[model samples]
Target: MAPISAIALLSFSLLSISISLILSSNIIEDLNLPPPPDFRSTILKNCKENPLIRYCNAVSGDISDVFKSTIVAQHLCNESKNPNCSNSFTKIDLSTRPLIAPLYLSFTFFWKYCPLTILTIDLSNNSLKGSFPSDILFCSQIQSLDLSYNGLIGEIPTDGFTNLTNLTFLNLSYNQFGESNILRLHYFARFNSSSFLRSGLLAKDRKFNVGSIVLQVFLLIFVVGIIGCFGWRCLQRPDLLPFFLQRKHKFTQAVLKAATDGFSEGNLVGRNKRVEIYKGILRDGSEGLIEIHRGKFSFESRRDFVEECRILVQLDHKNLVQVLGWCDNREFRAVAMRWTDGYTVVEWLSRNPQWKHRLKVLMRVVEAMCYLQDQWPQVGCEIRTSSIFLSNDHEPLISKLKVQDKNNPSKNVYKFGVFLLELVSNRSPHEGFETGETGFVEWIKIHYRHHVRKVIDERMKTTVITFVQVKQAIGIGLMCTDVSNNQQPSLHQISKMIDRVYQSSLVSQSATHRHKIQRTPTNALKVNGD
Candidate 1:
């Protein structure tokens, strides 16, 4: 009897050990133990199959799948946290991975948890192909997404990414997307982050081949620099000018008047808050615009015009409304910009029903604003949506809008954020509306406080303008137009906030749409002059 009992105990011990071994092996395989076969291939396969594997591989081998599963399951199982993520979800460090596909996929697969809220994907050295997937929108929780240095092709899908509502950083550089394609992505805050997408392939290739082009540019710059260095160079020695200045095909005002048919109202191209622009042709058949300001003319206004001309001369961005030259005769202070054949951003949005185009427009506007705020800090300007004009090609052009305070850079930045909110909300600036209130900000506050739906535009109610984006925009707008100017974000911080707001808005829209929450159209009146 004692021998039989001992045999049974030995058999039970062996069975228990076998079970433990199998469990350990399974955990190791799930956690991608014993080092990845090849980090790149592992990433690629996991991205194509299960993005969670990439996240799993990011951690140390000792960190078992049970731990990860526990955290993920905790968030998923808990009703309150399932909508978002628990505290443990925020601790995931996805920045270690070099590939974007896995990170992008992981974020998408477990979007409900917001697993990648603060992670950065640096796929800068990968050979990944195909267009950015619509599933990328699911990463609304991610703060930074870097897909630079990859072989991504095709136009970025502007409409599908309404899901990434929390993303603060985005980078898609050194790819095969052409000049036009790159221009299309100029609206997103991510594109303007650094020298990542500085020059397009077309521009770079042209610069490489055209040596004379470079020389000419350098010569022009050298002459300008030399003039700056020597006070008597160009300023004092006006008579000893270069041949280019000497050769002139100047046109008389009478000739310009005739070409424009006596400056007919029908020839008018645009009317800003300050000036009316008319299309005109010179005797040599060169076409341009002649601007005529209707408001009070003063010495300060003249100085403003000259200063604006100087700034315009220095500007070279594609999205900016180009200024060719200016004429300041005794009677008028006019500036001639490149003739834009399209309408304002508002008008363009009104006409185009496609969300893709609208998104492209929004991104372009944001990018242009960021460039202006960053590159030209001296302007100390804030862009008002009323100042943004669109050409016939539907390309957005950010005009020299309001200078909030030339001396106070902080004020300028604050106002700039407000302007961004205007674009996001499809509302006019504080002063753009003809209502009794000073601007949309005051009106929004009043409506918000009163719980009135009239604050929202009627046209946008039935459209794709989700409640989430609207709320997010309102929140951002409030933050930007905060009573305390000191709290306003810098250009970099504002860019990140804008990215986050955009991501959140997308997520909110997705959630609302997915849940089929039918939004009732509020009886709102058109506030701006159509």
Candidate 2:
């Protein structure tokens, strides 16, 4: 009876335990509860351990805690209603959430909540401002990550990103990332280049040293300076310029022929054995005077012709005729100059005979002579009234050069003396002297000192004329034309003496005019009344 009682007690205890277990299982099934209640506890634990999860609660001021709790309740309810409900998140798409903070995640939180391994995390267009999130390195399993169109700055964490072996697609475009080492880009070779567009993460290969950059700049400046000096020199000597650069003053035979109307007789203004001058309309519809060399020449002569033409074309001065261009051909070579429509100095003097105008014309002529002498000391230019043209404003333009007179500066001075005599006497050098006299200079010399009044032009005998100034000018001419002597002054010195004479003449004229004004009857009456 005692053994039976002990066995029965043990069996009763075992049956009670089984009943409790069955009742608990039946209650759980009837209530439609979830598999477990540890989900909420696990999330709370993760929030404590994960900085990103805590950030949500801190940024939302505990509001995110209530929201997360509500989400938990809803998830629990859904799982209770549907046994197949999933608890793992493969992707977390928080794109275009402008109020969200910069993203960060922890491995423990990610593994606990998303055990299947996170495949994508899109946080683009969030206006999230900060450096690249360092905590993203914990989510190494993420295959497609997007953080584009944000305000993220600082260098990209390339070293930490290399640990993400599972990452396949990355879109960090439109962020403000800083430059990094070029070697770091190789770690992301598997991804497309567009993934880093506008992120400022593209490493530039800055191989140029400061020294090399400075050297390149210095070379550029040196080249520019050399070119500038060449240009300046070419302005004075156009023949020295490159052939292509000289094309402005080069012309073809066909163009010149068309301009001069095939060198017709009607177009011929003057002719000589060696040269023929034609007045022609250029292609640009402007009048041009063309001088064509008539006879054929040797190679050296042609070369000399070209060299002379180039030099003549580049002689730029207001008181000189501008040679526009030149044309060279197998048949002939031609020089072109702008056609000036004005009278010779002799004709102009006949129309305007005022002493002031005459003095002005003479001074400008002297200046032009000095300029030519400076340019070609060995070549003498014949200075005479016939070789000077007067513009509408009475400005003198020296037009002719006596190429036959070479290496003779005295000849230039003699010619200038003859020109001065002609200007003052208003008589042609060819006709003024007696038939028996030596030349124009001798005729002027004989009458200039003793019979100076006779040598002066009758037209300039008015009261406005100052005889003292006239005597000074005649003296200069006489000195210049003294052929028996070889002590002729240089052209530059002659210019200075002429300038001084002009200034003194101005003073004497003013003084004489003042005396005449003081002697006037109106002035005497005013003085008597006072």
Candidate 3:
């Protein structure tokens, strides 16, 4: 019995050992299971290499908060701080966040921080400045990027942009890109060309072959030689040059009387309180308009008038009518202006109903105003549709006497805004409209927000015009005409705004034409004026 009991005890001990071994094996397996991967080290390594991170660290600024917050949100924080991992975000919108830094550094920041999941990054209106942020190409996973309303300059680098296979939307408008040749790049094929508005960049890729370059150099040398010889001849015998080119072409009273056929009633074209305008032909067969001041003046007053005429002639601009010279004789006090063959804006619009043509003319008029504002801020000139002439090719030319008003440039801004409304609505600023509005600007303001179709010209209704672009133009007009807003945009700013609208319309047209653009030497989208 003792032997049997000892055997039973040994069997029981073996059973206990087996159970313990099995449990220990299971515990060992559970302990051996691999832990989740920690991304903290990787993130730190990347941040260390990130130039923007280092820059922020050195400066001790809150700019790095964007990066730090991103890290925490991605569950890439230190284990002691936040144990539980959170779902990561796929977008980082820092638009209008008022970032003031070198633009390149911002690109570097985006490059290192943007993850594979990131789809959109907006860094617009940050007042960023510098060359184009080509470093943004490293963010290959991003599908949308907006860097508009910044002060970026230089040529847009086309390299590696195609690597962003997922990219779908891009906005680089209102920035200062030096060239617009990017429109020809295949990477930007899917994007809207209007994304380049207000860039002040013209689409022109001038590729000169070796042979063509050599030929151009030869022609340049030949032209220089001809000019040099002509200059030498002028120096030797000034009489050889035409009197008109030699100096201000002063015409005598007898010559003016004969040119105007003795100032006959048939020759008179217009008359105002200050002057009488008459068609005339100079001795050199040059046709022009003679403006004879109504009354004779004192010798001092005549001298001042002659000085003013000299300055007016010296004010050279493509949009301005050429001043031939002045007449300060006893019988008449007149000024000669070279005749330009074109009708006034009002007459021209009557013939051409196309919105593009009218917008082109308006652009030139604004440009001329900008030129006047920039080059001759002290010189005053009045602009009206009747006084604004569109040449046979639709180039706008301002025709009027130079008035002395230091405050006229600011006034011109308001006048141009009114002109925009006039050109768009086909209604005179002076004429009362059916909307019970006396002023054209007020009429446009009332209708542009909701009833814009009614505000636009009836002729433009038949044409294929983009309503958004028209609205943009009308909005600019409203901004300019707003008397309550003291911070009115300058003529230069207005010129750019109009140019943006014009370019946007051109893009829409080109897209409709199956993206076929007729390229010219100056610009691909420039109209008749250019």
In angstroms, how far off is 384's CA in candidate 2? 2.1
Once superposed on the true structure, which residue ranges of model 3 sit more than 4 Å away at CA? 1-247, 272-274, 433-438, 462-465, 515-530
- Number of the top lDDT candidate: 3
* lDDT string, candidate 1, 1-530, tens digits: 22222112112222322343323423324334332234334333333444443244533343233233323333222322223332223323323344433533443334332334324334454666666645545445556666667677766665654456666666666665544433335345344535346323335534543775788899999998886866444333322355465222222344446657888988887677877778977434567667776555688777776666766666667778666665554456666556666666666556533333444555566566667767775553335556677766667887664333454656655566555455544566544677522366666667764553465444554334555455555666666667554676655665676666556556766877756644533333335643
> Across residues 108-196, which tens digit of lDDT does each residue of candidate 2 receive?
23222232234677778988887876665655667888999999988777888887888888898888776753235777777766887
Comparing 1 with 2 on TM-score, the higher-scoring candidate is 2
Instruction: For each candidate, give its TM-score against the true structure.
Output: 0.40, 0.48, 0.49
Q: How close is candidate 1 to the true structure, as a TM-score?
A: 0.40
Better of 2 and 3 by lDDT: 3
State each candidate's clash count.
14, 0, 0
Model 1 bad stretches (over 4 Å): 1-255, 258-266, 269-276, 282-287, 293-307, 349-362, 380-382, 392-394, 401-407, 417-439, 446-454, 461-465, 501-530
Q: Distance from true position, residue 96, model 1, in Å? A: 89
